[model samples]
Target: MATTNKTGAIGPVPFMNDGSAALGVPLAGLTGDDPKLWVRFYQGTWVLATFVPAIASIQQSFRPRGGDVVIASIPKSGTTWLKALAFATMARGVYPPDTAAEHPLLRLNPHQCVTNLERLYSAGQESMIEALPSPRLLSTHMHHSILPSSISKNPDCKIVYICREPKDMVVSLWHFCRRGKPDVSFSDLFEAVCQGTSVSGPFWDHVHGYWNASKANPEAVLFLRYEDMLRDPAGNVRKLARFVGQPFSPAEEEAGVVAQIVRLCSLDNLKNLEVNKPSSASQPFANDWFFRKGEAGDWVNHMTPDMARRLDAIVEEKLSGSGLSFA
Candidate 1:
């Protein structure tokens, strides 16, 4: 007889495992305190073992509408920020960024406003995605290469990819994961990053997938860096708006809409919202988990000099000659 777990999951589920069957897939060994944090080598990309089924479904069934804007990034690489910024920018005409307290972003977590493609598919709620209005704003952690031809080859579908420095990304990911699995070691994640086996990792390949695409199709794929956004968020907002074919008009710019969007979506503003508060223990993820220190170079506080150097060397070597220097 199967036993019911605390989560109502039947049978003996692995700790931290999402309980998704990985049958027939090549699974990588667990790297953290959670024995179920398995990753699968799928289609040449390393993905969380649980997300494999969703990825397969997305690749086969996702139909991209013209003018759909897909927000792509390696996890923890300013994805939340980009989603908020993009959503605010695109919908400025409907909900003025400066004065809409009733704005969807103000009331809901950014993740709720812009659905994640894989998670939606995983939940079998893809119908929710289809029901969304056209020129929809969607988010994904999937690598560009893995995206189905319906999206990748659709010239009308725009992709905006954001990436952070590998060292900082690993640090952010460590802190983020630790919130849910406090026993997971930072060293294990750092090693996984270096070995190219972390969830949605082999970070280099994930970055390369979009980096090269952006290079080849600058108009269709907008490449962004988290560090650069910190320098001039308004500038990036303008760039994002323009790339999505929702460029700010002269009047909107004159009214300081860009500045309003920036302020509305700023980290300080979002983190304190009631909707994003740390969830109850029963919830799978607290909305607040996505609102950590959105700063660049935070790796310094968490990593030893030797650890930084080792990861830096690996990132540099893997990205060399690609004209996509993270250093």
Candidate 2:
């Protein structure tokens, strides 16, 4: 039986570390001061060490059905916002994004509505995933290179990946991390990101893995930029619905369904919901932690001119030949 935590969510179960040392899944200790941030080097990328076992299990056990859609991204890169948009897009038929009074999104956090795939596996709730009705909506921070063959190789499974410019992502991540450990210096986090040791990082590699895949198989992988979404959300929502094989009908479009969805999932609308508000005593990070300044270029407020140029140069160098410029 899966244990439930104080927040009424399934609790994570401890995984047994058998003498599988010969498997070559070596762990990387990035921050000796904080074991929580330690990572494991797997398949040429760094992932949080705590999630290695669950990732392994997911690789071996997950069976993707034809309609499964995975929302993929690096952390703090507008994941919550994308989740809201995608969920609202996909479930619009049954729960009208504009008209429904009891839509699941209105009452549940986006994370609760579309749970992270790794978290479900880690919590011994894989059965919950299997039980959920299709077409299922899932999210992940894992690099595309490391996803299971059932998902990465399956032509039937669709991946919608969103990424932000490295500068803004770094700023958003630092603020999110500081929510738990208020004393963690921004410089340390920034340095960890620069060194490619931050969780699910080597930011360039993480972004390129999907960028290249989307280029290779445009139909299966939909690559979106956070800045682009911010600029034209209604257009993106239509694009999202179309990619997931649920394009809006002419009647629905004429009725302004697309505009309604864009408004329903807007950051301001979601951030203010009671379900997303913070309750410090009960939950370590209620949905509120995910709702920060949802604007691009906020990095200028936190990072100095030199820091921005340094990170931008590194990103430019790494992504030079890939045709995936953040400039």
Candidate 3:
């Protein structure tokens, strides 16, 4: 029963009726009249019910090359901070001494600095990937189940996976998930978090996959914990530098390069920057406050005791005997 407006194709949109629809393209079984499929026209085409799971699968199948340095994390798990740190560490030798502004670390959002594997592998991006120089940098949220098989087999490429405490993750996720729609209830969002139905989730599986990989090949995979980084960023930064084969110079250390990078990428600095604010060339969020309250344990303020217990139970069940627990 739904009709599309005359416009170009838009990406997938999921709705409450267990049906989904997209704009600008004709898709089978997306009509509102179908009892099983929910249909709506967003932007122009009918988004189909089947697109959600398909996109998830498609995104998961993305791969990186041997020369690539991949930053992998579940969403809202200090991904931005890790990306900045990694990017900065790699680019340390590229910039002139005492010239801070020229560093990509100072000027760009980590998302912009690193390419997503899914976007690069899409039909339009083949040429772009090919043109990139060796030792290309990349990022992805794909779980271990869907990671490109080559990543495990290839010894040349380096993978860094960052993890955050589940409580903070859920809180950050709630804020992020509600940005597009104002009325999203925390209880409903908590349900999605527990089920791993949120974007780029099934959280435990994602973390455990890399955890096992790091255990198996410590040199190939680097595991970072957000709490550890928060506690001793300088020390962790040094560790990351060594892992990437780019140890900081004694002069750089004395000049406090680690602290400089942290300050440059701090929530306050990033939030106020022109690139992150709306209307800039590199804005990462449609709305402001993307870097709000980058502290740990904020979930204690928002989650009720019952909700906390439910989330803990899910985590306990998934992490049992894995020898991995979040901070």
Candidate 4:
């Protein structure tokens, strides 16, 4: 039998590492070459992350509170930016632009503002999360299948999922992982991504799950593209505001609420903040490394035309008949 923690859930280490108890291989370290072979599969497509122990804490324990908002994305797909936008849009009335001193965004990193359910559970903080007030802002990188049934089935809970152009995502993920993994070579990273063996991959499966779900349940899941947001931020911000049940009133729009929010959360502005600079253990990244060129098609600089074409073809094949396309 699997050992249980004090909360009566399976212990994070034993549950995830037992092959008889979980599907997929469990990773022992950070430098795995074949993530498909190293990471344990749970709920469905989500691999039990190497950094966490309590995959079952979410599936079996987490209960969604109504009006909860979740920001979902594969890593490096504009997660931090979307968190800022979502928080600003929802809290606009409470934290008007002129009230930056009182605004949480000014003092806290985006990751701190939006809690990650999996991370919280992994750290044995489920009770703390449950104590948070209604409309709690949560973030998750888990695939939809792995999310607790409480979240997926809760009509009142809203999920906003963002995906980036696959080529750009691949390049960005490679560079991002290198922050702590100096030994990882670009060639290995490229091959791992192409073969769908990187963390939280296969990439096609991860995004398409939300794409199809959004089509079936538009009211519950809002699918977004990172490049599309960059093209027209204010317009996209309005759309996001509407989805989260916080539509900006006519007067608020006239007062430039959308522009102010975007400016405050812009890459250039966020990169210069002191909260983001603190090299803390809790921060996802050590510094503003997450702010590197938020440009679309930046893959062109690093990937050969042939390299781009192959990844595109794989994405095309995987997303075929799904009625989804990323720029």
When summed lDDT is taken over every stretch of 10 residues in candidate 2, the lowest stretch is 13-22
Q: For candidate 2, lDDT tens digit of each residue in 55-87? A: 899999999888789999999998988988898
Which one is best on lDDT?
2
lDDT by residue (tens digit), candidate 4, 170-227 = 8888787777566667767777778776777788888998898899999999999999
The candidate that wins on TM-score is 1
Worst 10 residues of 3 by lDDT: 9-18
Model 4 pairs whose backbones collide: 12-53
How does candidate 1 score on lDDT?
0.80
Report the Cα RMSD per candidate: 9.2, 6.8, 11.2, 8.3
Candidate 3 — which residues are off by over 4 angstroms?
A: 1-66, 96-100, 280-289
Please give the distance, in angstroms, between residue 105's alpha carbon in candidate 1 and its true position after superposition: 1.0
- Cα deviation of 35, candidate 2, in Å: 5.2
Writing each residue's lDDT as its tens digit, candidate 1 over 98-206 gives 7667777887778877777877776667766665656678888898889988888889889999999898899999888888678668887888788888888789999
Candidate 3 lDDT score at position 123: 23
The TM-score measured for candidate 3 stands at: 0.77
Evaluate all candidate structures by whole-model CA lDDT and list the values in order: 0.80, 0.80, 0.63, 0.73
For residues 183-294, write the lDDT of model 3, one tens digit per residue.
5677766775576655455677778889999998999899999989888887888888788666777877888887876676666777777666665333224424356687
> How many clashing residue pairs appear in each of the predictions shown?
0, 0, 10, 1
Q: What's model 2's overall lDDT?
A: 0.80
The pairs that clash in candidate 3 are 19-38, 20-47, 21-47, 22-45, 22-46, 22-47, 23-44, 23-45, 24-44, 24-45
